[model samples]
Structures are given as structure tokens and as C-alpha cells.
Target chain A: MTMFTRSDKVSETGGGAKPPARDDTPAPAEAKRPQATAQPLSHTAPPPPPKAAASTVSVISKALKITGQLESTEDIQIDGMVDGDVRGVSVTVGGDAKIKGTVYGEEVKLSGTVDGKIEAQRVVLTSTAHMSGDVVHQNIKIEAGAFINGHCRPDFGKPESKALPPPHKPAAAPPEQKRDAVVGAP
Target chain B: MSALSLSSLVKPPRRDDAEELPVSHLGRALTVRGVLDTEGEIRVHGKVLGRINADCLVLDTGGLVEGDIVARDVRVSGRLNGRIFALHVTLDSSADITGRVFHHTLTMAKGARVEGRMPWRPLNYFETLEQLPETRQ
Candidate 1:
């Protein structure tokens, strides 16, 4: 039979998953600027900056079954099972939904169970979510009681390539001392 | 590149009303019944019985449904042993559907298999294909 549950109630086990490592370290000069020029603590008034507010339009109820590839330009919610690939701007998997294929979206929130890989800009695994595949995203958050297995990699907008390090080179010694010994004929 | 940054700024304001997020897996101890009417999209990965009326209905691979479905667009990638009526029906390469399907457009990808017949009518189709001559008497 079919059952519907929210995305925040999937009872998954295990600890949280950490994000992947970065190769290059940002320059220290740029990092120190914020700390060097500290503003005085002001409790009186602070104007808000222009914020980028996100919009959400529709919701998915608990009674849909999709088997083939489903692609959309708008945000989507899944409360049922999907057997094929799914691509959307944003996706939310409810606690009662079961996803068996890959998911490609900008933002993905999981409170249920996903058996395949997930690729998104931002991914959040709630306390009730269960994931069993790799996650490739720029940002990732795992809440308590979530069960996740596999690798987590950062999304830098470039295809990840396996490159080896450059060959080592020994440092050369100074040339003045050798020239002085030859001129002295000692 | 700088002008592209302004595109987001000129975009419309955010809406407080948001869509519902999807639920990955179904509850272990719950039974679903009756009809599910949705305007957007719905995917079922668990067992579903009865009628489902929606815009788009997807049955993911490995999902099972033992009922009838009526929708504008219907797709199956898993296993379905029920009746289906839609404007367009597509079966992915891995789908295994046993029930009859009535649609204006039907597409079955390679590796997909169906064991039912498609009975055409002047105006409408039956809820279950079992009432047809090929399935029953």
C-alpha cells in the first residue's frame, strides 16, 4: 500500500557527513581584512542589506507515482515514489516518499529515503532522512538521526579531474663561491 | 558579467507560499487508499491501491502499484499491475506494466514490457480493463 509522510519524519540512523576538502587555500591577505577593520559594537540601529529572497510556488501531495524521467523548471515536492531521473530547480523529498533514482537540482531537501546519487547546489538531510548514495553539491547539511553513506564532494562549477602533483626540483646552490675558488687557484 | 548580477536583483520578490517538499520513502506502517488528486507532479515508490488523478504521475523503478490511474500525463519506470487512462503514457526501459492502458499517445521505451491490451472507444474508457472482452468475457 501507499503512505504519506513529511520530509522531516524519515527515521534514518547514523552520524552526519562532512563536506569534501579543498585543494587551494585562499590568500591570507584577503582573509585578514575583515578582522583588521573591526566596527564598533552598535546596539542602537543597523540597516539591513539588500537580501536575495527566494520564492517557492507549488507543493506535491502524497499521491503521485512517477516512473520515467521527470524534468521541470520550477520547484517540486515528492511525496511518492520515482523510478527514473528527476531534474528541477529545487526538490524536497518528504518523509513518506521513496526515490530510487538520481536527482539533479539546485536545492534538495531530504526527509525520506533516497537510494541513488544526488547532485544539487545545496543539500540538506534532515533527522528523518535516509540516503545510500554519493552526494555532489556545493553545500551540505546533515541533521541528527539521519542515515547517509558514500562520498561528499564540493561543487565548484567545474568538472573534477584527477591530476597528479608536479615533479620535485632540488634547490640550486649559490655560484659566487665556486667562481672565487677557481680564480684563486687554491 | 556585471549586468548578469543585476538580473537577480531585478527578479520578482519571494513568495511566502511555497510548494511542499517531496517525501523520499513511504511510511513503513501505513496503508494508502482512494484517489489522490494533484495539480503539479507526483511520484509513488511504494504500494498504492485505488485511483490516482493528477497532472503527471510517475512510478519510479522498483515501485509497485496495484490500482487504476487517471492523469493528463502518466509514466512508469517500475512495476504496475493496474489500469491506466491518460492523454499521454510513457513506459521507460525498465518498466513492467501488466494492466491495460488507454491513452491518446503511448510510448514504450526499449526494455519495457506490458501484458495488457489497449481498447479504443468513441468517447471514454473503462476504469478497469478487466471488464473488456479480452480480459473478461
Candidate 2:
């Protein structure tokens, strides 16, 4: 009888302790609950990747027509019509492209029609290129079938003494000096 | 650069035609200070200080636009200091806009900061828009 009673007391205590221990397990579950909530917050963090994946090169597609200045510190690929000046690090003009204004770049590859001048450090005119204006470059390569109407001068990065001075001094100084002479004589 | 002719700018491409056209991407290091006219889509991640005419336009995060935008669909997740004239407009949570948004349909997220009026218009109104009206303010 004593053995049966003692075993019942021990079993009762063990059963009583198990309920509190089960209650204590909820503390860690509550911690896990916050982690579950954090997963949704992490889902929100993925939106920046698309923005980060934006291309570094600027592309002007064939259907586009720009009528102002385009200046870029990176590469530019043009496949459309541009009525404005284009300045870039590396400029590539596609075969169907048409540019009316000057193109300034460190490296320029042309396979299109350009009506204005090209000023570049390195210039390459592909077989399909049709250039109407002068090309000023430090280094140049022209394919056999490329059509060019103007001279190609290897004068890029050279001092502006010959090219710049004539327009600035002669054009400006003559008008001013003549006006001053007339005024002083009067 | 030659001036952008109003006749060329007035003709907005149809939605079906724009879908077949390629998308133009203006990168973060680029700065355009003139008119951008496109029959297709344009995604701007840099700074544009002039008018833009496109079928669809997306101003990505960190992009800055300071002029008028005329498009069929315009989505903004960046900063815009000018007006937008579009049929469909969606302003993301990170958008910071300070000009009027004239659209036929508009969706604005919770955190979007808009300091101007959003006037709803009819579908035909956008289709018949020949030129952008002058800003009275």
C-alpha cells in the first residue's frame, strides 16, 4: 500500500511540473515569432536589387530622337536620330543611327551617318559609316567602304594654338580694334 | 542642336506600337539637358532637366527629373520637380514629387510624398493632348 501511494505522489509531482515546463516553452516560441515577422521584412529588402541591376551604359534606341545635349561619364550606344551634341566616354553609333551635331568622346566607333564633326581620342569608322564632317582624333581607323566627305586630322589633345586662336583673336580683335580706332579718332 | 518641332512631338505612339520598340536606358552617370522624344519606353536612372516625350517612362530610384513628362504610362520611384501628363501614373513608396500629376489612372503607395494636385482626366483627353499647357504657377 505504501509503494502504491508513494508512486502516485511522484507521478502527480512529475505531471504538475510538465505543465509549467510546457508553459515555459512558449518564451522561445515567442522569440521565433519575431523571426517569422523578420522574414516578411526581409522580403521587402529585395526591391533594391532591380534598381542595382540597372545598366551602366546608356542606350538610345532606334525609335528615340533626342533634340538636346547628351552628356555621359560612361559609355553611350546610339541607334536612333540625334539632333544635338553628344559627349561620352565611349560612344558607339549603330548603322541606322543619324546624328546632326558634334560628337565628343574618348573613343568613338561609327557605323552610321554623322553630319557634324567628331572629336575623339580614338575614332573608328566602320564600312557602313557615312561621315559628312571632319574628324579630329589622336588615332583613327577607317574601313574600306566607309564614306567620308571631310578631312581626318590627327590633332586631338594637341594645343589649341592653331585651331582656337584664329577664330578667337582675329574675329574678335579686328572688330574691337577698328571700333576703338574710330572712336579715338573722333 | 536644333529645336524640337512641335509636329514631331505631338504624335504619341500607340501602346501596341510601343511594345515592339526597344527600351532606352539612361544610366546614373548621364545628364541630359534637352528634349528626349521616343516612340518606345525610357528608363531614367540619372538626371534629366528638360522635357520628355515617350510612350512609357520609368523614373527609377535616385533619378531626378526637373521638367515636363508626357507619356502613356509613367512610373516614378524617384524625385520629380516637374509636371507629369500621362494616362497611367504609379507613384512608388520612395517617390518624392513636387509638381502636378495629370492622369487618367493613378496609383500612389503609402510612403510617397506628393506636394501637388493630382487631377484625374479622361482617356480621350490624353489622346488628344497636342501640347503641354503652360504652368500658371
Candidate 1 chain A, which ten residues in sequence have the lowest lDDT sum?
A: A41-50
Off by over 4 Å in 2: A1-50, A161-186, B1-16, B131-137
Specify the highest-DockQ model's number: 2
Query: What shift in Å separates residue A4 of candidate 2 from its native position after superposition?
Result: 63
Which pairs clash (backbone N, Cα, C closer than 3 Å) in model 2? none
i-RMSD of all predictions: 17.8, 7.0
| Residue B84 Cα positional deviation in candidate 2, in Å, after optimal superposition | 0.5
Give the C-alpha miss distance for residue B106 in model 2, angstroms. Answer: 0.6
TM-score of 1: 0.40
lDDT of 2 by residue, B31-103 (tens): 9988898767788999999999876789999899999988766889989999998766778778999999988
